[model samples]
Structures are given as C-alpha cells and as structure tokens.
Target chain A: AAGVIQSPRHLIKEKRETATLKCYPIPRHDTVYWYQQGPGQDPQFLISFYEKMQSDKGSIPDRFSAQQFSDYHSELNMSSLELGDSALYFCASSLFGAGGPYMYQETQYFGPGTRLLVL
Target chain B: EDQVTQSPEALRLQEGESSSLNCSYTVSGLRGLFWYRQDPGKGPEFLFTLYSAGEEKEKERLKATLTKKESFLHITAPKPEDSATYLCAVADTGRRALTFGSGTRLQVQP
Candidate 1:
C-alpha cells in the first residue's frame, strides 16, 4: 500500500530564513494533519485540513501556515525560522466519512517525517 | 481542553517478557483513541484504534483495549524488534487532529 509521502526528508536552515515542507497524502484520503515532535517529546498537532478546507488548528506558531491543494496534497510554510523550530515534522492522512456516528472510526496513517535542523 | 497522559516514562524488558502500557485521557466527547509505534528518527506507525469503551483490537504481539477514561496496549512475548516508543493519542468530536501523550519508551533486550 502507498503511504503518505513527504519531501526533503532532511532540511537545514538558518535563522530568519523561510522554508516550505510538502506532503502528499495517501490516495483517496481526504484529510491531512501536520504535527511537530521535538527531541524526546511527543508529537504535537499543528493543523489539519479536510477536503481542501482548513478543518482545525492547534498550537501552530503564527509564523507558520499550511494549506491543502486541490489534489489533496498539503504544504506547511514557515517564515523567520527560529532555532527552536528544529524538530521532526510529520504528515498523517485519513479517510474521513461523509458524516454520521461512524466518523469516529477515521484512522490516521503517518508519513516518514521530515527532520528540520535550524542553525 | 483535551489531555492524554501515558505512564511509565520508560520501560525495559527482556526478550519474551510481557507487559502493558497505559494511556489515560480526558476529553469531551471522545472520538477515538489510537496507538502508534515510533522508531528513532521515523514517523509513527499506526497500530490500532479503539472507538468506544470495552472495545479491543489486536495485531501480532500487541493488543489494545479501551475504557471510558483510559486505554492499554499489551505486548506479549515481545522481541527486540518490538522495541520502540509507543504513543497514545485521542481525537475529540470538535477536531480532526489528534492530541498525543508524551509516550512510553519501551526497550526490549534480546
């Protein structure tokens, strides 16, 4: 089975620079979620999109923004990157149900993740 | 606010030892509870999802059970290959994203 694909598995950037991370979700999965995991910490929810629309937001920084394209792929753009931003970024995809009690069964599958090192 | 808490910050077991990891959560309107295994420097691998209390799911040497306030992942006759950080997360009715616990780091020595 094809899993979610992430671009630039490893990235290095300097302070104040800009970076863009791309994620291609699994086929037929309509929802994409982004998370950041700092060293020795658990993954934190950043944002999520459902059917190309922003469905939810979490602790994402103001300097960071994300969007899902028409093809169901998503991108996370960060500006004025700080050293504290260094972490592993992960993208997860899930097939969302139309709407009903069964929507609770949506299971998310994750990608390999991108390691960001801000220098 | 939704909160997920995993116990035993770290656990060490010998090959073939059996143990269980706990994840306690507090959320309004629980949507689902999930278990994932993550290797060093890699994304989390999905393990199981329990949608309601009394639900149970299993895969290989792992079994997950959920109740109203907590979930448990039991590993039986584990091998070193099963060593990894096990994360527990939950989704609420208000959001599509998951709120994760810090995770339990399991080290199985062969």
Candidate 2:
C-alpha cells in the first residue's frame, strides 16, 4: 500500500535562514494536510490543500507559506526561521471521493514526518 | 473556539493491564472524531474514526467509543508494543483541518 511521503526526514538550519519541505501524497488521494508537532506536544494543524488550491489554514506562522502544485504534491516554505520552528512537520493525505459514485468522509493517512531543527 | 482535552497526561501499566484514556471535546457540528497513535519521533498512525454519538469502533486490543461530549479509548490486555501517545482530534463543519487534543502517553511495561 502506498502512503504519503515527505522529503528531508531531518533538517538543520540557523536563525534568519530559509527552508523548504516537500510532500508527496498518496496516489488518488486528493487532499493534503500539513501539521507541526513540537516536542512533547500534540500535532497542530498548519495548512491544507485540495486539488492544487488552498483549502484551509491553521496555526501556521506568518513566516511560513505553502502551496500545492498541479502534480498534487505540496511544498511548505519557511523564511527567517526561529528556534521555536524546530519541530516535526507531518504531511497527511486523504481521499475526498471526488469524481466517484462513492461518497466518503475525509480520512487522513500521515507520513513519516520531517524533523526540523533550528540552531 | 473548539477545545479538546485529554486527561491523565501520562499512564503506566503492566502488560495485560486494561485501562481507558479519555478525550473530551467541544466543537460545533462535529464532522468526525479521530484517534491516532504516535511513537516517540514519528508521525501519528491513524487508528479509528467515529462519526456520530453512540458510535463505536475497535481494532485488535483497542476499542473507541464516542458520545456527544467525549470519547474513550479502551485498551484491553495491552502489550509493551501498545505503548505510545494516543491523540484525539476532531474535524468540525467549519474547517477541513483538524483540531487535536494533547495526547495521553501510555506506557506498558512487560
């Protein structure tokens, strides 16, 4: 079974630097979601996209921006990183039953996550 | 604002000990309630999804039950491998994104 895949399983950066994270959603899955989980904290919703369009946004910081491409892959860009930005960034994918006779509720499947550290 | 609260931030049990973790949530027009298991340094693994009050779902040694106000994750005869942080989240009609509760860390000792 195919699952969501995220690039750069680990990342290290310094303050005032920029970083980019990529997500490849599961095949046939139409929705992509991003989350940030700090150490000892629960995963916080960051942003989401459906069909290459921004669908929703959450607690994402002002220095962070994200977009989905026509290929259905998504990228999150962060600039002027802070130490607090160090956390596990997770990308999840789900199917919306788009263009199908079956109507399915949103159910998410998460990737392994990218661990980012700001030094 | 929507809120999800988990109780007893941490728990420890001997192998085969049965216990339950509680997740209480307050949201408008609940679309779905989900349970996930997260290891120390990995992303969450999806467990169960309950759509309405009185709904119940189970997998292996875990069972999840939902009501109008809360949800309970009951682990039966758990093994050490079952130890992990259990997280609960809710998707409301207002947003496609989920609001998560601080997870309950469960440790099963052999």
Candidate 3:
C-alpha cells in the first residue's frame, strides 16, 4: 500500500505504433517521477508530475507525454514508437515534506519498471 | 552545467575482496548525493543519501562517505551478490531534478 505500482510489466510494440505505460503513486505522495534506462546505461530523467500537473520534462521527444489524474495515477504515452525508444521505464514517488512522517525515508520508492521493446 | 561522474567504469573482484567506488560532482550548491544499486534489468535500489561533507553512513558491508566535491562507496569483503551497477546522483539545492552519473559496474566472482 506504500509503494509505486506500474502496469504491464513487459510490452512489445511494433515500430510506429502507440504504447502506453501506467503508474500508481503511493498514497499521500504528491510527486511522481519517471526515468528511462537503456542497455548498459544509467537511468535518464524523462519527466515528473507534482500536484496533479506536469512539472518537468527532460530531453525526451514531444511524442512522449505524461498525465496525472486526480487520484495520483500517472500515465506515460508514446505515440509512434521508435527502435531507439526501447528501454526499461521506471516510475517513482516521493512526498514533499521535510521530515520522515512519510514512508520509505526521504528517498523515492521505485517500481519494478516496465520493459518496453519497440521493434 | 551540473554534472556527476563515476570512475572505473567497470570493476571485477573475487569474493571477499574489498574496494571503493568514486563519484565526483560539479555543482553550484549541493543539496544531496545519492547512491543506488541496480541489477541488469531492475530499477535502482537506494543505498545512501549524504547531505554534507564529512558525513558517513553504513549498511551491512557497505560504507558511504561524502566530501565537499565527491563521495565514495566502500565495499568491505564483497560477495557475488554484490555484483551490480552502482549509480551516483546529485540533487542541487534549487531544483528537484537529479543529475546522475554513468555508474560503475562491479562483478564479484566466486
């Protein structure tokens, strides 16, 4: 009940097809973050959601968009997937307050990640 | 430009060997430094968070120490289960974004 949950653990999509990944943040955690890790590389920041709005976007393409619902569920949509987009996508959540009334310390709790393969 | 750099892109050690990994940074004001361990196909597992210089934290066989400009993760008598990519990240004072390093891959063989 206090961890990040991502849907569709693995997905394979044809090139140029649309793919969507979903995430459910921990209760009372207002911040949701997403990262993409390619093979043999570190995770790169994709975007973040705070207060039910898109707060930041990294160097990702316009084709990649995310939305946060009122219930703190976030969805990442990729329109027209490309081979380069194939990677493991991770979702994380964190609370904004200063101290440890929150769960899992101040560190973000990451989901198991969604493996997306755009062939 | 905020940046984080990890050294010794890769390392191999026999079981029971000890080693240290380095993470250097260049930022205006450092709010936090984080260390994470990641397996081949999994998300990073948070290990430590250093907020100031001369601060240190330990868990099991790993100890993390921090300085003004860099941080070090020392592994004591590592085992095969310690084999993973260790990533370091920096969160500046003003922003919530985290700048991450390329990471150091450790392979502990039996």
Residues A3-119, model 3: lDDT tens digits: 788988999999999998999988888889899988877888889888988877786789999989999889999998999999999998887754233321256668889999988
Error of 1 at A107 (Å): 0.7
**Model 2, B31: alpha-carbon shift in Å?**
0.2
- Chain A TM-scores, per candidate, are 0.95, 0.93, 0.90
As a whole number from 0 to 100, the lDDT of residue A107 in candidate 1 is 85
- After superposition, which runs of candidate 1 have C-alpha atoms over 4 Å from their true positions? A98-105
User: Candidate 2, residues B9-107: lDDT per residue as tens digits?
Assistant: 999999999999999999877888899999999989999988878999999999999999999999999999999999999988768788899999999
Selected candidate, larger DockQ, 1 vs 2: 1
Mark the regions of model 2 whose C-alpha exceeds 4 Å error after superposition.
A97-105
DockQ comparisons of all candidates to the true complex:
0.84, 0.63, 0.45
- What 10-residue stretch in candidate 1 chain B is worst by lDDT? B90-99
Weakest ten-residue segment in model 1 chain A by summed lDDT: A97-106
Task: Provide the RMSD of all predictions against the true structure, rounded to 1 decimal.
Answer: 1.3, 2.0, 2.6
**Which CAPRI tier for candidate 1?**
high
| Ten-residue stretch with the least lDDT total in model 3 chain A | A97-106
- Using TM-score, rank the candidates from best to worst: 1, 2, 3
Evaluated with lDDT, which candidate comes out highest? 1
